[model samples]
Target chain A: MTFANAGTLGALPGRRDELVAHLTRPSTALAEVGCLLYEVGVSEEHPDTVFVVELWTSAEAHRASLELPEVQESIAAARPLLSGEFGGFRFDVVGSPLRGGA
Target chain B: MTFANAGTLGALPGRRDELVAHLTRPSTALAEVGCLLYEVGVSEEHPDTVFVVELWTSAEAHRASLELPEVQESIAAARPLLSGEFGGFRFDVVGSPLRGGA
Candidate 1:
C-alpha cells in the first residue's frame, strides 16, 4: 500500500514567501530511499499557508527521512517561521491515479 | 499549472469500507476533462475518516467536473454516508516529484 501524509502549515505574518521558498526547495525529501512523491503548494484561499502532499514507499522510509541532516536542518530553520500547530493527516493509501489504479 | 484540492471527510459509523469502495472506484474522475490525480485514503490514525487529494489541469476543469452527472450522482450517494462537514483546501501547485521536478 502507498503511504501518504497531508499536512497544512501556516507562515508567520509577512514570512509567507520566504517559508514557501524553503519548503518547496524539496531536494532532501526526494533524495530519500523510499520517496515517491513530495509536493508543495500554496493555498489559493490562504496565501500565507502551505500544503504538503507526500508519498513514500513505506511508512518506515518516511520516518527515516526525518533523520537526514537536510531534513532536520530544514525543519529547524522553518520552525520559527511557522504560525500555529501543524495539522497533519496520515493515511494508508489504498489507491491513486498516479500508480495507474487504486 | 497543477490545480490541487485537499478535502477531509469523516465516514459515518461502520461505513468506512463501503465509503472507500465507492470513492476509490474512480472511473468518473479519470474520464473528466482535466483530471490528473485523484487519490482517496483512509487515515491510519482515524479509520473512520477519509482524505481526498486531487490534481486537475485547471481550476475550471475541476469545477466543470463537478457538473458532470456521474460526479453529482457520486456526491449524492456519498453524502448520506458522510458524517461531518467537508474541510476543503484549495491550492496552486508550484512543483512536484511526480511531474519530474515540479
Candidate 2:
C-alpha cells in the first residue's frame, strides 16, 4: 500500500505567490527524501489559496522527511503568510482500480 | 475565500467497509447542495484507504453538488469499490490566519 498526504495551505491575500515559492523550494527538498511526488499549485477558483499534494513511500518515510530541517524551516516560513487554516490528513493506499486491475 | 476540497479514496483490498457505506450515502446528499462540513470518519494509516474532506461555498457551489442526480448515483456506486487513484483538489480560501485575524 502506498501512503498519501493531502492538505490545503490557506494563504493570506497577497501572499499566495510568496507562500507557493517557499513551499516549492523545500518541497523540492522533500522530493529528494524518498517523497515520490510533491506538487504545489494554485486553485482554479480561489486564486489566493494554494493546494498541496504529496505521495510518499510510507507514513514513516513521510514523517522522516518532516524531521529534516529544511522541511521544518519551510513550514515556519509559511506561518506568517497564511490566512485562514491549513488542514488535511494522511492516508494509506490500500487499493487502486487502475493499478490493481480491479 | 473559503473553499477547500481535498481527496484520496484509494480503496480496494477487502473493500474498506463497503466503500465507506457508499460514500456515506451520497455524502449525506452532498450535504444539502450548499455543501459544507461533510465528514467521513474512516481512515487511519491506509486501513484499506479512504479520506475525503470538503468545505464548499463556491466553485458554483461545488459544481452544484454534482448536478444532484443523487450525486450521480453515489459516484456510480463507488466504481466497484475503488482501489488506488482517487485523487483530490479544490481550494479558494484567500486568507485565513485563523479566519483573517493574521
Candidate 3:
C-alpha cells in the first residue's frame, strides 16, 4: 500500500524562501529509496508555511529515508529555517481513480 | 505548471470511513477536467481526518473542478459527514524530481 505524509511546515519569519530552496533541491537519492513523489508547495495566503505532500512505497520506506545521510543533512540544513510549527496528517492511501500506475 | 492542494478534512466522529468512501468513489469526470491526482488517505493516528493531495494542470483547473456537478455533489454528500475543520495549503508546484510526466 502506498503511504502518504502531507503537511505544512512553518518557516521562521521571512525564511520561507530559503526553506523552500533547501527542500526543492533535487534528490535522486529519494526516488532511489522508494519515494514515489515528494511534492513541495507554498501559498501566498500563508506566507510562512511550506506545504509538502509525499507518496512513499510504504511507511517504513519513509522512515528509512530519514536515516539516509543525504536526507539527514537536508533536514539539518533546514531545521534552522523552520518555526517548529507543523500540521498535517499521514495516511495509507486507500485508492485513486488515476489507477496510479505512475 | 502543476497546482497542488494538500490538506486534511475533519470528519464527524465515527464517520470518517463514510467520508473516505465518498471521496474515493470513481470519478472519470475529474480526469477530464485536468486533475492529475486526487488521492485520499486516512491515518490511525488521526482517525477523524481524511488527508487529500490533489495535483491539477493549473489552479484554474482545480477551481473549475469545484463547479462540476459531480464534484459539487460529492462535496454535498461529504459535508454532512464533516466537522467543518479544514487544514492545508495550496501552491503552484515548483518542480518534482520525478520529471512528473506521471
Candidate 4:
C-alpha cells in the first residue's frame, strides 16, 4: 500500500513564497528513497499556509526518508520560515482511480 | 497549474470502509471532467476518518465535477454514512517534481 503524508505548514507572515520555494527545490534523492509523489500547494483562503502531499512506497519508506541528509537539510532550511503552526494527517492509500489501488 | 483538494471525512462509527468503497468506486466521469488524481485513504490513528486527495486541471474543472450526475449520486449515497465532520483545504499546486510544475 502507498503511504501518504498530507499536511499544512504555516509560514511566518508574508514568508509563504520563500517557504514554498525551499520545499519545491529538486530533491532527486526522494525518488531513490521511495517517494512517488511530492506536491506543494498554496491557497488563496489561507495565504500563509503551504500544503504538502506525499506518497511513498510504504510507511517505512516514508519514515526512512526523513533520515536522508538531503531531507534533513531541507527541513533545517525550512524551519526558520515556519510559524510553528502545523496541521496534518497520515494514511495508507486504499485506492486511486488514476493509480489503480495505490 | 493543478488544483488540489485534500481532506478528511469522518464516517459514522465503523462505517469507514463502506465510505471508502463508495469513494473509490471508479467514477470514470471524473477523468472526463479534468480530474487527474483521486485518492482515498485511511489512517491507523483515526479509524473513522477517510482521507481524500484530488488533483484537477483547474479549480473550475473541480467545481464543474460537483454538478455531474455521477458525482452527485455518489455524494448522496455517501451522505448517510458520514458523521458530518469534515476537514479539508484547497490550493493551487505551484510545483511537483514528479509531474513537472503542476
Q: Model 4, range A48-89, lDDT digits (tens) per residue?
A: 999998889999999999999988988999999999999988
> How do all models score by TM-score?
0.87, 0.57, 0.89, 0.95
DockQ of 2: 0.09
Best by DockQ: 4
The native-contact fractions of the candidates, in order shown, are: 0.46, 0.07, 0.54, 0.53
The alpha-carbon lDDT assigned to residue A80 of candidate 1 equals 90
Output the worst ten-in-a-row residue range by lDDT, candidate 3 chain B. Answer: B93-102
Q: What are the runs in model 1 whose C-alpha is more than 4 Å off? A: A26-29, A97-102, B28-31, B97-102
Residue pairs in clash, model 1 = B96-B102
Which runs of model 3 end up more than 4 angstroms from their true locations? A100-102, B97-102
What value does the lDDT take at residue B28 in candidate 1? 46
Model 1 over residues A22-85: C-alpha lDDT tens digits? 7767474454578887777886568778788777887888889888887798889999999985
Model 1 agreement with the true structure over B25-86: per-residue lDDT tens digits:
74745545788777888876787888887778988898898898877888899888989757
lDDT of 4 at B17: 91
Model 3, range B15-40, lDDT digits (tens) per residue? Answer: 99888888888888899999998888
lDDT for model 1: 0.77
DockQ of each: 0.48, 0.09, 0.47, 0.57
Q: What TM-score results for chain B in every one of the models?
A: 0.86, 0.33, 0.94, 0.94
